[model samples]
Target: MASIVKRMKLGSQGLDVSAQGLGCMGMSAFYGPPKSEEDMITLIHHAINIGITFLDTSDFYGPHTNEILLGKALKGGMREKVQLATKFGIKRVDGKIEVRGDPAYVRACCEASLKRLDVECIDLYYQHRIDTSVPIEVTMGELKKLVEEGKIKYIGLSEASSATIRRAHAVHPITAIQMEWSLWSRDIEEDIVPTCRELGIGIVPYSPLGRGFFSLGPKVVETYYEHDYRKDLPRFQPENLEHNKYIFERVSEMAARKGCTTSQLALAWVHHQGGDVCPIPGTSKINNLNQNIAALSVKLTPDEMAELESFASAENVKGERSWNKVYSWENSDTPLLSSWKTVE
Candidate 1:
């Protein structure tokens, strides 16, 4: 055997995963257009063949359509090829987004996910977001119960603050922390990264390409479907798009100098964060998926990493990632001390 399974342990619970994981969100809807069922199936099979096994998904995406698509992909022998990870907690109910960490919701969500994924047990189950009103202990306590019952192999959290992470860790060992991290989105590096490294929690980054802003094409930007959320994102605005184009052109130039695609340069830079960091870039097209996975081979030297950092710091990239009133993506708008209360 030529050493196939890419293993990077997430935490104290001994939960190891592939060096690169496949994020299945785009196949359901969020990217731009709805991808065909056949493309999703072929993409899953191709991922297995390339030795990329860690798969990340959530129940809220497509309001359950993505899990159904993944279930279809896992049929027969292909199910054995992945170390599965899925989340529940943040949900959209009656057109209103809510975070439900209630124990009742947890059990119901797991059952629904099981039915959709067609899997007996999920390898890694995460609390997509903490319902601050519910208390971290209460939520993790319920998740702990699931672990004992064999519904999940390990526990993880997403977009949680450092204090929340500490409180949750005290309740039970957190295997990994999934958040948005890239050269463009380095906010997590300040506190979250240090906390995860100190606690041995693996960091899985989503949106490693700055929402395709690196080769960052104009044609690609205009192709967004009506339902696509990126159209509202600050980065995609006409004014910011023009300003950001220069930054991406620089990124493309750097990629050409290093002999790789702009996407590859972005992903490779994310991988450089540390050995414990793994990025799951989602794409519905097989060509994009292939280009993304090939990023693993594009390693940057120490000097190159420094150059990348300096290049990014110098850019006057316009617009925050989110609309001003709503708040920035992968970052907090409310102050750290303020408490979160549920609408219900």
Candidate 2:
């Protein structure tokens, strides 16, 4: 908690939160492997005690499992210490995605999340993906009503285009926009950032660690598990990883000179971006959580920021940031954070 989180409201009148939030995605799945519930619970409590206030989760992770986990984690007065955010709307079947933002579904999802998280209200609710099957106006309109009913505090969108964002905003002023942001990705800088600023919405950057690629991330996953999803991703392939290490390789060297790990540098880099930008880095280990908390204190000078950017600018990291989906489609910032995503 050494670095004061430059927290701002997700949207004007929205709840205040730590400048950097905690992405709860990795605790249940993704990255290298699945973590035990006991370990994840410990990590969640640790994160809370350390003043990391933003708690992120979604119904999609285990198709209702992650939210349930968080519900159990917040069994006590711990719920009062957090600014919880959970997403709904993206439908999943057999591990494949099916975007569904129907208004009826939105209400149903909200109730389910409430029951899963064991909370009276979700602080900030988001549409996990833009459901083209239903109009954005129709979906957001229902969300506005939820706000009125006090079922949710604020609304946010993920992986949505500028047009969709604007349409949603017209229905209700968005509190924050959650998506992937890191030193490697820049797609939102040009449009999304500007729009959020103009509308007074906050930006919550998920995977600020580049899916743990910035430092100390394993080279690969041998076998896919029921909860593990990274094995199917392109970046995990041996061929891509072999070439992609170049992006973070330099980061490791920089960390050596700075007397920190590549992970520290990555988190520091996220903090240096802007007061409005909050990077949520997820980890299920107490040691890593401690290290992540320490990142709030890792300072980078303007020159250092430029240097890091300069070094990352040249390399083309292999693999795609997202699989074949509209949200995973090409964007500008992908090259910087997702440099290794397309190397192969």
Candidate 3:
């Protein structure tokens, strides 16, 4: 029997989910080679059994295979037990990744995701990335229509600017905003996070474990396979990796003092951030899943929170989160939405 985890509401629209979600991308792609289907299915069942039911996946993951995998696992009455969240808008065309938020694309993606997941409606559907080419209003309007049509239950935006979020929410109620938020990736706190709070939009922090860097230490990057996405990330470069080791050491030392693993300490920090916030950490192993579940109990003191804050400051961390400049649009420090007018 799995333990019961607390639930948190992700938007004023009454979208509530477990305090932590399971990011399913790693099971099908990224990090290294894909895990066996049987193992991935078993892991998801274990997640549901343990009450970690807010499951996250994107259509682009495996380009389409992950949704099929979830569909297979969610069969046999497991579908009703979890809140299924998947993303759209990210596509690989002609060997390059592109974001498409056009209303037509939105509808197509939703329909395809519905078919792939074998679900009547998705619990939460997020626009994976803002297609700067499309007006946020237009995209939100299309999503609004989907809710009315019973294709999706809730709406969300990932890696969108605060202004974009406001614009989208104005068009339709946004249930959640997923972004790269962890002890090391705290830039969203400057504005995006506050904006979510003001709009009653829930904040779901993806890569809350900092893509396994925070949990496995800085040197873990060197162990990534040639095809691993982390290999191209600037922060994982040799020089930058060496520079960022201090962050891992600082958190590890604290975890040791608390008698918890570094990963648990990092997750505890995320859990302590707020009630409306949920962190979805990814893993392909049962042991890591259990360790992450245990983080719900690893509470931190106010002083400890402040200490970790200083240790993980952006100024102390080296290199950009991504090596490709195009991906930087997701960063909170980017220019305001007014500068990047959406296509009319």
Candidate 4:
């Protein structure tokens, strides 16, 4: 039986998707060794069978591998059943990750993603990162062209500042803005959330479980493999992970009182943020997928929401979300449009 999940509207352009989305990054890369393609396909099929219809992937996730995986998974009659979301703009060159938002690059990336996904039009296409080098309007203009040509259904921005979002929205209606918003990552609430609410843009939180910190606890970080992306993140560092244990412990206690798993509690908090907000929690295991989907039913009381909010406030978090200096571009509170040089 497919679980009956509520639908949420993303962006003002009539983009409606399942309230909780499935982030497909881990099935291809990032968390650890890539899961077997057959396993991931089965998992995605199960997700759809259970009513999780919003599937998120990125052309850069596997540097073109993730979309390929999704393409294979959505074969037959599966593609039409879900709202597919994929991102572009981040690419690896000379073994270094680079951001590109040039209008030409935008069109090329979209065409390539369509080829990889084996789909005529992407349901929602997001700029993986704000390319400060190109004026946001230029990138948005290219995306607008894609929409007009029926290459993409709607446009979105990821890790963009409130100012950049406003500028991009002026060019076209941004259906959704993806950000790191979880119980522990509340920085977006300071300005980005308010701006999106005012602009009628939908919010899609990428790491709503704090990169598995909220659900798996600090111990999971200790065992991360050298190749695992989280091994390089500051929050998962030895000292910071120890300090962050307090947060997991507190959340576990609260979950115990609520008679739900810690992950369910964590996801429920994000779900309560607003109807316009959707959280995409990724997992390679089917058990974890079922657990995450169950979160939709773990409704938190107003008092519980307040208490958890106080406990998981940004100040309570002990480490930076990313240790890479390049990631600062995504974390900036203010847009640095003038500081960026165009890619030649």
Model 2 lDDT tens row, 1-344: 34344455556755799766788877776643557888888888777776787999898876677899999999979899899999996776785778777788999999999998989999999998877656677788799999999999889888776777777788788888887877777666787888888888888888888776775654435434565666666776778777767777888888899988888898889887777777788877788877876787888999999888875562566776666556541321111112333442
Selected candidate, larger TM-score, 1 vs 2: 1
Which parts of model 2 have CA positions greater than 4 angstroms off? 1-8, 31-34, 217-227, 329-344
RMSD of 1: 3.2
Name the candidate, 1 or 4, with the larger lDDT value.
4
lDDT of candidate 3 over 8-92, digit per residue (tens): 7777998878889999998878778788999999999999998899999999999899999999999999998999999998899
- Put down candidate 4 lDDT per residue, 1-344, tens digits, no spaces: 75677787787889889889999998888877778999999999999988899999999887789999999999999999899999998888998888888889999999999999999999999998877567888788899999999999999998888888888899899999999888888878888999999999999998899888887897786657668888878888888888888889999999999898998999999999999999999999899998998999898889999999888777777888877645443443333345544333
Score each candidate by Cα lDDT. Answer: 0.79, 0.77, 0.88, 0.88
When superposed on Cα atoms, how far off is each prediction in RMSD?
3.2, 7.0, 2.5, 2.3
Error of 4 at 228 (Å): 0.4
Q: Model 4: which ten-residue window has the lowest total lDDT?
A: 328-337
Predicted structure 2: lDDT: 0.77
Model 3, runs deviating above 4 Å: 328-344
Residues 292-333 of candidate 1 have per-residue lDDT tens digits of: 877888889999888777666635667765454222224322
